[model samples]
Each structure stands twice: as structure tokens, then as C-alpha cells.
Target chain A: DVKVTQSSRYLVKRTGEKVFLECVQDMDHENMFWYRQDPGLGLRLIYFSYDVKMKEKGDIPEGYSVSREKKERFSLILESASTNQTSMYLCASSFEGYEQYFGPGTRLTVT
Target chain B: QQPVQSPQAVILREGEDAVINCSSSKALYSVHWYRQKHGEAPIFLMILLKGGEQKGHDKISASFNEKKQQSSLYLTASQLSYSGTYFCGTGVMEYGNKLVFGAGTILRVKS
Candidate 1:
């Protein structure tokens, strides 16, 4: 079975702090994505990488950055955490434009 | 642009039926559907790729209309396990691998 594992299931950070959320998928999929989900907003794409070292900005990419140095791992970084950034972050991997398999998600709270 | 989903929320009893619609303003290569239970990552339910093609998994089914750039998910004889937030992700040529999701439709099932 394909498994997408996240570094943390829950996290708390202070305002202005730099935070990193990691996601690793065992399926070796070519595409990896970072999304933030909030109540009523659904899942908004933050960023995505189709290949190692290649990244593209999604609709809601501000205040965030992503890294995909290796084929199996993708990272989401918050340059300066703020209270408004608190939400459930999800990582997903897919075979380029196909259906995606997702991680368990990390619920982050910024204070 | 993000697709618009109708019936923001719905309630259904076991064995009932429901439909969730997703419409996009831009032409699409495909429309993907996913289900996210409370506090969890979204899971791939199905994908509609061709115009007028309908597919089903278990009791859940979906249809795509290429001309209208719309898709609809049909849940027939709904089961308790079908309760969750249903999301439609649109695939646009300009967006590449990014799947911009809709606002989502929340579904609640009662025994």
C-alpha cells in the first residue's frame, strides 16, 4: 500500500517563528503537493513540485515555501508563522496529474 | 480559477441518495473527486476524464460533462461510511499538476 507520512500530526509555533512541515511518500510518485485546509475554505493549494528541484506556486502560495530535494520527500516551510496561518496542512503525492494519495496531515497552531 | 460546488452541506439518512455538483468556468482536462472525513486528509474517490462518461465505485458514482465543464457526484443508497466533506478538484492546462479544489460539500449521515 502507498503511504504518505507526515513529520508531525500536531504542531504549535509562536508568531514570527520559522516552521517546517515534512512529508514523505513511499510510492515514489513524481508529483507532490502542499495544501492548507480551513473551515469553509476547503483545501487550497499552496505549492506543488512535479519533479525534484522543480516547484510551482499555487493560488495561495504567499508566506510559504516548499522544497523537494529528493524523490520521496517534500517539505513545507512557513517563513514567519502567524495566528492567521493556523490550519490543517496536508501533503499529497501522485503520478503526475493522476489521483493523489495523501498524508495523515499536520494540524498547526500559531500563537 | 477554483470550481464552484453546490449544496454547501447536506444531511441524509442511510439508504438515501444525494448529489454534489462541481462546475468550473475554465475548460478542464479532468475533474477529480475526493472525500475527507473530519480531521483527516482527503482520499481519492474517483476521476471523470471523458465527456459524458460516468464511473462508479461501490455505491458512489460520478459524471462529467465536457461541454459544460461540469461534474456531478452521485451517492446512491448512501451508507454511514459515506459521511464526510466531498471535494472536487479541477485540472486546468495552465495549472499543470495542481488540482485546485472547490469549497467542498459537507455531508452528514444518520442511521
Candidate 2:
């Protein structure tokens, strides 16, 4: 079975703080993605990486950046956290053109 | 663009059936379905790649209409364990491996 793990299950940060969410996948998938889930908004993509050092912006990439320095790990970075950035962050990895496997998710709270 | 889901929520008895629909304005290369229980990561349910193709496991099935850029998930003889939020993720050729997910349809099952 494929497994995706996130660095944190829940996190709290003050406004103007920097936050990082990490994800690792054991399946050696080529594509990794970051998404934020909010009520009535579903899962909106933040960023995605197809290969090491290759990144692409999804529909809602503002205030967020991603890093894919290695094939197994992907990280999402919030340069400066804000209250509006609080959300459930999900990381997913998949083979090109295949179903994505998601991590357990990190619920981030910004105060 | 994000896919639109119908019947934002639904309630069903143990033996009843329900259908959740997802529609997209753009052409779709594939349609993926996932079910996420409360406080858990979304789990991949099924993926429909061919136009007009129907696929399922157990009593849950899905159909993709490529021409109409839409897909529908069917749950028959639902069980308590089937209660969750159902999300449809649509993949477009132009979007590469990224999927645009719908807002989600919440399902509640009563014994």
C-alpha cells in the first residue's frame, strides 16, 4: 500500500510568522501536490511539483510557495502566515496521469 | 476551473441508494472520486478514464461522460461506513497531472 505522511497533524502560528508543512511519500511517485481545504471551498490546489526542482502554480498559489528538492519529499511554505491562511493542508503524490494518494493532512491555525 | 457538484448534501437509510454528480465546463481527460471521513484524509475510490465507461468496486460505482464533461458516482445499498464527504476531481489534459476538485457532497447514512 502507498503511504503519504505529513510532518504535523496540527499546528498553530501567530500572524506574521513563517510556517512550513512537510510531506513525504513512499511510492516514488513523480508528481506531488499541495492543497488547502476549507468549508464550501473543497480542495484548492496551492502548488505542485512534477520533478525535483520543478514547480507549478495551481489555481490558488498566492501567499504560498513549495519546494521539491527530492523525489520523496515536498514542502509547502507560508512566507508570512496570516489569519486567512488557516486551513487544513493536504499533500498528495501520484504517478503521472494516475490517482493521487493523500496524506493525513495538517490543520493549521493562525492567530 | 473547479468542477461543480450537485446536491451539496444527502441523507439515506441503510439500504437506500444515492447519486452524486460532478460537472465541469472544460473538457476532462479523466474523473477521479474520493471519500473522506470526518477528520481523515481523502481516500481514492475510483478513476474513470474512458468516456462513457462505468466502473465500481463493491456497491459503489461511477460513470464518466467525456462528451458532457461530467461524471456521476452511484452508491447502492449504502452502509453506515459509507457516510462521508464525496469529492470529484477532474483532470484536464492541459493541466498535466493536477486535478481540479469539486466542492464535495456530504453523505449521511442512518441506520
Candidate 3:
């Protein structure tokens, strides 16, 4: 079975604080992705990593960055947390060109 | 560009039928369907390639039309378990590495 785990189920951060959301996948997939989901807007990709230390921006990458220091872990960084950044963040992993398996998701609230 | 989904939201009774549509403005090589329950990860339902046939799960089925760059998901005899947000991911031939998703269609099934 494929297992993807996120570091936190809920998080609250103050304005301008730095926030990090971690994700780990046990399937050894080569692709990892970070997406933020909002009501009505659905899930929008933030960043994706194809290989360790390799990252690419997705449609809504502003104000967000990602890290993939190891194959099993991928992190999403919010350099300056703002109220507008509050949303449900999801981490997903998949084999090359295959279906993705997602983590439970981290709901971040910026105050 | 992100794909477009129709009937932004739908409410149905048990044993009812519904159809959710996803249309893409860009050429697509593949399309994926997923269902995400409240606060949980999205689960992969089916994937339809450019020339692949329709895919189904029990009473739920999906068809992809390469020429029209669209896909439709059919849910028959809807059950309570079918209530959730449905998203369709689109993959273009130009860039096979990423999948662009639609806004999502929310389905609410009542007893």
C-alpha cells in the first residue's frame, strides 16, 4: 500500500512568520507535489519536485517555496505567512507519469 | 490552463443519477478522475489516455473524448458514499511531467 504522511493536520501561524509543512511518502515515488486547496477554487498546484533538490513552480507558486532534500520527504515553505495564505495544503507523490497518492493534508491558518 | 468543470455543485438523493463534466481548452494526452472526501486526501478513481476506452467503478463510469478535449463522469444510483468533491486532472502532450486540475465539482448525496 502507498502511504503518504504530512507533518501536521492543523497549524496556526502569525503574520510574517515562517511556516514549514513536511510530507513523507513510503512508496518511493519519484514525483512529489504541493498543492493548496480552497473552497470553490479546488486544488491548485504550488510546487513540484521531480528529483531530489529539483523543484519546479506550478500555477500558483507565488509566496511559496518547496524543498526536497531527500527522496522520501518534501517540504513546503511559507516564507511570510499571511492571512491570504490560509488554506488546506496537500502533498502528493507518484511514479513517473502515473496516478498520484496524496497525504491527508495540512490545514494552515494564518492570523 | 486549468480544465473547466460544469455544474459546480450538485445535490442528489440516494439511488439518483448525475453527470459531471470536465473540459480543457488545451490538447490533452490523458485525463484523471479523483474523489476527495471532507478533510481527506483525494483518491484516484480512473485514468483515461488519449486512445483508451472508458473506465468505471461499479455504478460510476467516465469517458474521455480526445477530439473534444473533454471528459464526463457518470454516477448512477448514487449512494451516500459518493458525496464529495470530484476533480479531473489533465495532462498535455507538450509537458507530460505535470497534471493540471479543474476547479472541482461538489456532489452531495442525501438519504
Candidate 4:
């Protein structure tokens, strides 16, 4: 079965701290994405990478950066975490225009 | 712009049926549906391509109207395990591989 895995199931950090969230997929998908979900806001795309070293900004990309150095791993980075950035972060991977397989998600809290 | 979803929340009793709708302002290349249980990642339920087709998995089915740029998910004879937040993600040519999501519809099932 295809699997997407996140580095942490939960995380807590201080405001202004730099944070990194890692995602790895065993499916070797060409497209990977990072999304932040909040109550009532649903899932908002932060960034997506189409290939190794190729990245695209989504609707809500501010304060966030992503890296896809390898085919199986994608990384989301918070330059300076803030309280408002606290939410559940989800990582997904898919082939081109197909359905996505998602990680279990990381619940992040910035206090 | 993000696609819009209707009926932000709904409740269903066992064996009841429910429909959730997602509409996009821009023309769509495809629509992806997912179900995210509380505190978990969104799981891929189905994908509707641009051919104006309908598909089903288990007791759930969905229709996509390419002309209307809309998709509706139908849940039949709902089960307790069906309780979760349903999200419809829209993929547009302008956005490339980025799948923009709706605000999501929350569904609760009771006995």
C-alpha cells in the first residue's frame, strides 16, 4: 500500500522559533503538498512541489517554505512560528493529476 | 480563489443519506474528495476527472459536472464510521498541480 508519513504527530514550539515539519512518501509520487487545516477554515494549501528542487506557492504561502530534495521526501518550514500558525499540518503526495495519499498529520501548537 | 462548499455542517442518523456539494468559480480540470476523521489526515475517497462522469466506492458516490464546475458527494445509508469532515479539492489549469480546497463540510452520524 502507498504510505505517507510525517515526522511528528504533535509538536509544541515558542513563538518566533523556526520549525521544520518533514514528510516522506514511499510511493515515489511526483507531486507533494503541504496544507494547514484549522477549525472552519478547512485545508489551506501552503506550498507544493512538483519535482525535486521545483516548488510552487499555493494560496496561503506566507511565512512558510518547502523543500523537496529527493523523490520520497518533502519538508515544510516555518521561518518564524506564531500563535496564529498553530494548526494541523497535513502532507500529501500524488502522481500529476491523480488522487493524493496523505500523511497522518502533525498537530502543531505555537505558544 | 478557493472553491466554495455548502452546508458547513450536517448531522445524520444511522442509515440516513446526505449530500455535500462543492462549486468552483474557475473551470476545473478535476475534483478530489476526501474524508478526514477527527485528528487525522484526510483520506482520498474518490477523484472526478473533467469528463463529466459519476463514480462510486462502497455506498458513497459522486458526480462531477464539467460545465457547471461543480461536484457533489452522496453518502448513502450512513454509518457511524462515516462521521468526519468531508473536503472537496479542486484542481484547475491555472493552478497547475496545486489542488485548491473548499472550506469543507462537517458530518456527524448518530445512532
Two-chain DockQ for model 3: 0.82
For model 4, the superposed segments whose C-alpha errors exceed 4 Å read: B53-56
Q: Which ten residues in a row have the lowest lDDT in candidate 3 chain B?
A: B51-60
Q: Tens digits of per-residue lDDT for model 3 on B1-111?
A: 989999899999999999999999999988889999987899998888888854445667898898999999999999999999999999898765689999999999999
**What's model 4's lDDT at A84?**
90
lDDT per residue for candidate 4 within B1-111, as digits (tens), equals 888998899999999999999998999998999999987778889888887554436678998998999999999999999999999999998788789898899999999
lDDT (10s digit) by residue, model 3, range A1-111 = 999999999999999999999999998898999999998888889998999999999999999999999999999999999999999999999998678899999999999
Give residue B76's error in model 3 in angstroms.
Answer: 1.4
lDDT of 2 by residue, A4-111 (tens): 999999999999999999999999999999999999999999999999999999999999999999999999999999999999999999999778999999999999
Candidate 2 residues lying further than 4 Å off, grouped into runs, are B51-56
**DockQ value of candidate 4:** 0.87
Lowest-lDDT window of 10 residues in candidate 3 chain A? Answer: A93-102
lDDT of 3: 0.91
Residue A88 CA error for candidate 4 (Å)?
1.0
Which regions of candidate 1 deviate over 4 angstroms?
Answer: B51-56
